[model samples]
Target: MSAITVIINPYANRGDSQHQIDAGLQALATSGLAFDIQLTEYRGHGAELAEAAARNGAEIIVAAGGDGTVHEVANGILRAAEGSEGVASATLGILPVGSGNDFAWGLGLDKGVDLAIDRLRRGQTRIIDVGYVEAEGFPAHYVVNILGGGFDSQVNIEAHKIMRLRGFAIYIVAVLKTLVIYYRNPHATIRFNDETHEFDMLMTFVANGPRLGGGFIAAPHARHDDGLFDICLVHKTTRRDMLLMIPKFMRGAHLNHPKVTMARAARVEIESPEGFPSQADGEIVGNDVRRMVVSLVPQRLRVIV
Candidate 1:
């Protein structure tokens, strides 16, 4: 068997990921890497392929798509590890061939197939923290980058509806659309680090990395190896206030805003009487999420840098 397994999501980048995949495959071939390629046929197929590859003793499972693909592949690897030693036997790699390559960007990876393949050839790896989140009516899953609930998740949903744009522009348009169409913030109770905060929340973002939505610096100080999550809570505010905060987030300068609360924690619990939407690594986890428990797992996954 090949030492590397590449899971490609053909539907990434709004269904235009084929060119990137082809380029990545060519680079891998030229790099003298012994690898097997698998294309995802449906939504969660990447995870299934990754799990099977790990179970079969693949040394590396490369996610050759976007952040959603990375999310699935990581979940699969962790799941496979749970059956054996509770430690991932397969390392993870990323080819940022998607709209929002937030996780890859946070890892300091350049935005080219050749560059990604070069990193894979170098074979440098690091152990990074992973987040495990469980919510009502949703399967417990792993988050390798960030999870956003409430208004942030609604923006993600709107972003997916857009077809003409790519990258950060899509998220910008989505944010505008969400404000007009979905503005009701949920009443949330958040518990973390022996403190409970109750408020009408606009959103709650937990970050294992410093960025999301392509370029939004959600947690500029976050580090994947830190064994803790940087949490951002935005209190319910007017649409005008949200609009004013957008530029601040773009600059990673919103932490000091009066409506924003930023802290670091290893575990967090959130509940709401009004069910909310949530997305992890750009994949929508659930729409009617009433409760969520998130905890960090230190040094859980090995990743190629």
Candidate 2:
């Protein structure tokens, strides 16, 4: 094992993550571990730094922000591993500094700089499954948490415009705001396991881990090491029904509703008549995507739990 590379988004948590970044860096500096830190300045910088560091012999790549930062770092590591042999053996560490540390919560990692460091120092790591997406833009993206299209994507897009709130609160607001104006049930065909299903799909969630948008359990039983995605498909429902189901999502009980169905698959193929927005791990990744392939990458990355 070599030193670590910490990729941080200082503007995470609504630009309130600087304190956590400073504390994490200071702790790493004095921890007697050979390590270097990189602060991301732009949107894709975390991915770039992560890939470079992994290829250059970083043993562990730490993403010290929210799910977006982790998403970029994971994508970077996966890209590098595809070209480099030993790079795939590198582990991933997460310090939950972002507003929605959805992936971190799914991994059972507590939020806060000191707690994250303690878990990292404990040296317990596990090989977990990651989700892979194929679409028009960004040929491939590795998702450590969840990915979604349609209504869920719209909520994330709206959530980004909110600058004052953090965590579950902002997401709650986004959902309400989105329901007021956005309503789209794209004609969708989903195929998995030799079966084809059609729906007027309002939203679809493919989860590697459990949480999406902080605590909304899109797939309540999703597990990262399982090598299969727990899928949540939302069929067309009335505006009143959608509004009433917000609390159900918070409790992860939406699957019991008539409009939602849960399934599992190693590979998922989706085609929709209307191109719509798509997001994964809390970051809006693509727009107007009419076709996509989601597959499970088993034992893709080692993560400290």
Please give the distance, in angstroms, between residue 129's alpha carbon in candidate 2 and its true position after superposition: 0.6
* Local accuracy of candidate 1 as per-residue lDDT tens digits, 181-296: 98668899999999999999899999999989887898999999998999999999888989999998988999999999999999999999898999999999988799999999
Error of 2 at 124 (Å): 1.0
Best by TM-score: 1
lDDT of 1 at 35: 93
Candidates' TM-scores? Answer: 0.98, 0.96
Clashing pairs in 2: none
What lDDT score is found at residue 214 in candidate 1? Answer: 82
Quote the lDDT for 97 in model 1.
92
* Candidate 1 local Cα displacement, residue 6, angstroms: 0.8
Model 1 segments beyond 4 Å from truth?
83-86
* Count of steric clashes across candidates, in order: 0, 0
lDDT of 1: 0.91
